[model samples]
Target: MIRIEPRQSSSALMTYGIPVLSAIISLLLASIPLTFSGAPIGASYFEMFKGVFGSKFAFSEMLTRATPLIFTGLAVALAFRARLWNIGAEGQLYLGAMAAVAVGTGVFDVPGVILIPMIMVMGCVAGATGMAVPTLLKTKFGADEVVTTLLLNFIILIFLQYMLEGPFKDPMGLGWPQSSPILDQGMLPPLMDRMRIHSGLIIALICAITAQFMLARSVWGLKLRAIGENPSAARHAGIRVNRTLMSAAIISGALAGMAGVSEVAGLKGYLTSDLSPGFGYTGIVVAMLAGLSPLGVVAAAIFIASVFVGADSMSRAMGVSSYLADLVVSTSLLCVLVGGFVARFKFVRLIQKKEVTQ
Candidate 1:
């Protein structure tokens, strides 16, 4: 007989080491696809590395790609910590983007100093509202947030399409389905003159640091954490479970909304359906890979971003399909899950006597 048993005292080293070990294992696994593609695994991998880190331009692009991920990852991590299961960050991101375009365009006529902050605040509000509806449904009507939030993503996408093609459509786009351009004052300035890396990177880093600190140190965080572990016990201990969950959901939605603002105001200078190439969904992967740790989310997001960016370059140079990058990333998640299992549990083979009657 064999049994799997969890280790009562898993070491800190094993906790951190699993992600690193799994990452290496995942890379090794990626070579299989390269072989099937008839590409030289070593050369392809080398090209990928160069694409990710060889030049300043490559590094900047990787960070830029990671910017939205950081926000959405933090959002997911925070919501999961509260057991809210806020799965609508993608929809919330679109809400934020739409709000940004609505406010940042010439409608406000405010100075850059004021317009920028206003746009950000409105974006956060829009995101919060997006999440709040589903949360409210869950709390008041016994609706499952997972279903409501998941469905909301589609609804928000349809709504966004209508806004872009109808009210907010730019006349100068020449029939393109894109929102009006954001004013110059509302644009997020790039860190360097020629690089696309913008202040949104700084904003993302700040949010991650703040989330980590609060999750570790704050009283509200403690309550949310407690609720995540056991809602009934937490309630018996005098924690207002519903209120805590609501607040956490709002915060999560706000963080996700910031991701939208980063893309539209910081990178694209306008809202569009493609503002997020599933960044919201990808954020879930980032949060899971980070083990729901806010600080860990930053590293995970950057790593995932580097993979995609490098994969693009690799695909172009190696004549391989870009879909391989998705395979590699999804494989990384699976490896991490297996590594986590290994870190926490061990299999034991037990001696058994044969049945004498048989």
Candidate 2:
């Protein structure tokens, strides 16, 4: 017989060591797929590394790819810290993009100093409003947030499609379903002369740092953590559990919304149906890989982004499917989840004496 028992206290070494071990194991497992596909596993990995960091241009593109991920990862991380399962970040992101596009396309005609901040604020508000629905359902009516949040994603996607195809469709796009290009004043300025990397990277970094500080040093963060650990206990201790959960949900949505804002204003210059290649979903993996730490999210996002970017290069060079990158990421996530489980519990084997029958 086998039994699983909870650890009296989680080991600090295992807490950090598991993630690294999981990543290495994921890589090893991924090579099996490559082997079956008849690709040179070692060379393919080398190419992937070279593609991401071999030159300044590649590194810059990696940063660009990581920027929105950082935001969404932080969004997921913050909410998860409070035990809020907010699966609606994708929806919030689209709503935010819609709001920013609304402001950029002549809804606001202020200078860059005013227009930029206005767009960001509007985006954040839109995201928060989207999150409020699920949070409200959970708090007021005892609804399951996981279901509500997931369903809301489809609703927001449909709404975004309507906006692009109807009201906000760019007439000059010659039938493309996209919003008009954002005004220069509302756009995020490029961080380098030749690279597409923009000020959004800085914004993401700042938010991560701020989140880290809040989680580590603030009384509010302490209360939120307490609520996450045990809501009944927290309520008994005079904490407003619902209110704190709501706040966490709103903040999570707002951060996700900023990801959409960054994508349109910083990279795409316009809102489109396919603005995100699943960045919102990918952010969940990033947060999990980071063990829900805000600062660790940055590194995790970069690593994940590099995998995608490098896999594209490897695909072109080796004739493998580009989707192999996604497989690698998914495999890594599974490994991390299993690792976390192992870290939290110990497996024990029990043997029964046969002498009882004798």
Index of the highest-TM-score prediction: 1
* Cα distance off (Å), candidate 1, residue 82: 1.7
Those runs of model 1 whose alpha carbons end farther than 4 Å from true positions after fitting are 349-358
- After superposition on all CA atoms, what RMSD does each candidate show versus the true structure? 2.4, 2.4
Off by over 4 Å in 2: 1-4, 346-358
lDDT of 1: 0.91
Model 2 clash tally, residue pairs: 0
C-alpha-based local distance difference test score of model 2? 0.91
Give per-residue CA lDDT, model 1, range 139-169, as digits (tens).
Answer: 8999999999999999999999999999999
Per-model TM against the reference: 0.95, 0.94
Report the lDDT of model 2 for residue 276.
Answer: 89
Task: Please give the clash total of every predicted structure, in order.
Answer: 0, 0
What is the C-alpha local distance difference test score of each model? 0.91, 0.91
